[model samples]
Target: MKSLSILITTVTFYLISSMYSYAQQTTDQIKDQQFTEAKETIIQDEREALKVEVEEINNRLQNGSISKTEADTLKNKAAEKHAKNIENRLIILKNTLELADRNGDQEKESKTGIYVGWDEDANDFVIKTSVKRKKEKKEVYDFRTKTGVYLTWGLLDLVDDDNSYGNTDVSVGRSTSFEVGISQTTRVFKKSNFLRIKYGLGFEWNKLTPRDNTYLVDNNGINTMEQFPSELRKSEVRFTNIVIPVYFELGPSKKIESQNYIRFSTQKQFKIGFGGYGGLNIETMQKLKYREDGRKVKQKIKRDYNTTDFVYGVGAYVGYGSFSLFAKYELSPLFENQPIDKNLLSLGFRLDFD
Candidate 1:
């Protein structure tokens, strides 16, 4: 009876031990499954975070606002994170395969596939794709036009054989006079290689100073006339002319492709053109004399040298953005049948627009 009881007790103890071992194995398997799921979750989260970071960094780069160093740093950080995430996924995959092998479960082992980490090359590939897209979207323009106002000063030369009173005179001066005027220019045509026209009106002012001298006889000595000097005499002549100028321009069409403070953006902004002009010039002259009381007397010899006629010229203009410099030589004389011959030559600067 004692032997039988001992046998039964041993059998019960063996069954309990076997049952406990089976339960512990089952628990371990469950833990492994949970760990694998958790690892996969962590890897997926990491990949998603990496994708967000990459997008943010790419946006900053495209915006062109960040410094070069900052962009490079962000790129390196993203690359490192990508490598780490790949490594973690690869480790989890290897462990999963090893766990399946240890359990000798053919089905689970067959199901366990290797996790290839996020492709390192893919980040660079995406960046390159974005860069190519941006490059394809750049734009370019062909032609442009602008205009503005201008002021000029030039020397006027007179060439005639007439005096202040329209009389034949070796007594009058034939020196070049000074002139000044203002105008506006507008561009009419523009092309890659083409011609342009600019038209504007100007007003010119001129003055001529004569040279001739006469002497007066006195009891004590010869005295120079106060108004007309004994050695040198001079007459003052003034003229005002209204002029119109047309400029023919030629050059590259893409001169003003870029935006700038100057009206145009081309070195070839300088142009040479023929100009036709028509206007009225009012001319007057004055003579001076000395009185016995030591006072000077002034007389107007010619007040209405007013003439309406055509004035034309050939000129050249050079421009730097909105600023321009010009020179012109008149083809016709200021007056017809005058005592003196006069031709107009002028130099001046102007502001232009389009």
Candidate 2:
């Protein structure tokens, strides 16, 4: 009976010791898990706060609200703070692991060295967090819109004239027109960047050199074409106009792989434009250079030779690259009810410099 009692006591003691050890291990594991969770929460919060601050700084730099030097300084400061936070987290982890080893928690110690839930691999026992900046909302119209001065040269023609002269009666070289203008262009929509609105102010000067030595004479209120007795080298009737023009422009923009700003490029792209212009007759004059009695004589005369006061025209342009073919047909007659009815037409090239 004494031997059996001794045996029973030994078994009971061993079982109680085993139970007590298991209970102690379970409590330690719970404490370790809670500590890990608390540390993770702290690290996550710090990382998120740092990310927000970095993003704000980058956005300001992208929009020209902050200078490069300031941005670099601010970003460096943020990086330092982030690095410090990570260093602190790593230190906490190291202490936790040491404490787990001291407490004989082998499982927690092994897991800490095995894996770290982060954006990158943590085999080196360091945690790195990154701040991803959102793409900026840039004002596209300022770059897309073009403004510049353009030069125009066109062939001037008279249609439905009551004069004795035919279509070929005007000198092609001397019957020339010139235009100088400044234009502003803008994209209509953000998505539809190809469509644009262009408008501007300009001047138009038309010179008509008759084929024959004919001078314009105002008979009462009529402009009569007459011949000069002297041989003439040049006789040109000029009309100067101040006009406002508007057009709908369509083209592929100069594509650039850029993130910040854009500029006008010399890239070739297909483009088309159609528009109209209206203007007032600002001046009218006739210049004549002729030889009279073997001496060169020059004369300029201002006349009310019955030219129309208001003028308007419809025009279209098509081209590849910076050069374009252009044509303009006058909607209003050049001269009112006279012995001959006439309208002006122009054909040439349109060059855009932005």
Candidate 3:
């Protein structure tokens, strides 16, 4: 009986020793797995740091603050270091995880599973990530309206025959005029440079001089005859007229580049239009010099002596940038009872606006 008890005690001690050794082995395996996981985390953090450094270098290059040589050197170093670190970390992680798996330790396997769960959670975090910001769009305008004023100088040409006034030997001289005007423009058709409308008001001055000794014969049924010299007839004749003009203009569409309170430059560079004009003579004054006035004395004539007539013309405009120029010819006689209808021609420059 004493021998059996001693044997039983020895057996119990050996079993306890074996159980403690197994427990210690499990703890060590768990510790090693945790250490490996920590090393992997440090490797991943170093890679992210390298990526940040590379991005910083690229940003510096874009900002023109870094030299090309320095940027290239830094980029190469970062790439090489990142590659080497990744290769080394991958080898270490593979070998360590393989050894932990071969060991068949439950604690190490559990730790590795937990780390995989953490990795899955990180992947989910990345998948759920988003950026929040307000998006904006650019604004644009289609059509624009503009206004302007201009000064013009031109010649007045009359197409009507002066001989109808019964002065066969009379000659009509060129009638020159000065004009000042204001204009307005509106965009009409937009695409294909199709159309626009321009309207304007202007004042005109005309001067006319007769070139012959015309005669007017008066005969009575009682055989009485009378002859009047051209100078005498003209002495009673007046020659100046003022006009007010209004016109409707149309042309190709254009874009405006620069503008002031009163002027603008446009992209629509060419224009063609036709309009009518009429004016009231606020003041028409004329002076007559005759042979009887061989002493060169001048006589003042009234506005009513010569008839005030309407003036009109057709014209075209062409230009680019801030400057625009136009040329037009008058379509009607500037004076009434004249031997010839002298037409007017004009050239003008205008400043445009919107």
lDDT by residue (205-317, candidate 1, tens digit) is 65545434432212233211233533233445556667676677654433444442223443435544455556566454444444544555555565444332566667776
Query: What number of clashing residue pairs does each candidate have, in the order they appear?
Result: 32, 2, 21
Q: Please, what are the lDDT tens digits per residue for candidate 3 over residues 1-354?
A: 252234334433443343343334434544555544544464556556666776788789879999878987886676557555655554444445445556443333223232211144332111112233334444334444566765554433333344332232333333345566676665564333345566666665655433444322212212111233434434222233344444444444444433322222355455554455555556656555555546545567554433435545676656553355666666664445554444445555544443
For 1-354, candidate 2 gives per-residue lDDT tens digits of 353245334433443343343334434533555544544454555556666776788789889999989986886676567556655654555554445445443234323332223222332223323344456878453465668777678888776644322364566666877888998887787545588887899999988887778877778776666898888888889999998888887888764545665444434888899999999988899999988888999999887578899999889998887688898877887776676667777788888776
Name the runs in model 1 displaced over 4 angstroms. 1-145, 160-184, 188-190, 212-234, 251-269, 283-293, 298-302, 306-310, 317-327, 338-354
TM-score per prediction, in order, is 0.40, 0.57, 0.39
Against the correct fold, how does model 3 do in TM-score? Answer: 0.39
lDDT of each: 0.48, 0.69, 0.48
Candidate 2 Cα deviation (angstroms), residue 97? 43
Model 1 scores a C-alpha lDDT of 0.48
Q: Which has the higher lDDT value, candidate number 1 or candidate number 2?
A: 2
Alpha-carbon shift of residue 353 in model 2 (angstroms) = 0.4
Q: Which of the predicted structures, 1 or 3, would earn the higher TM-score when compared with the native? A: 1
Q: Candidate 2: where is the Cα deviation over 4 Å?
A: 1-144, 161-168, 261-266
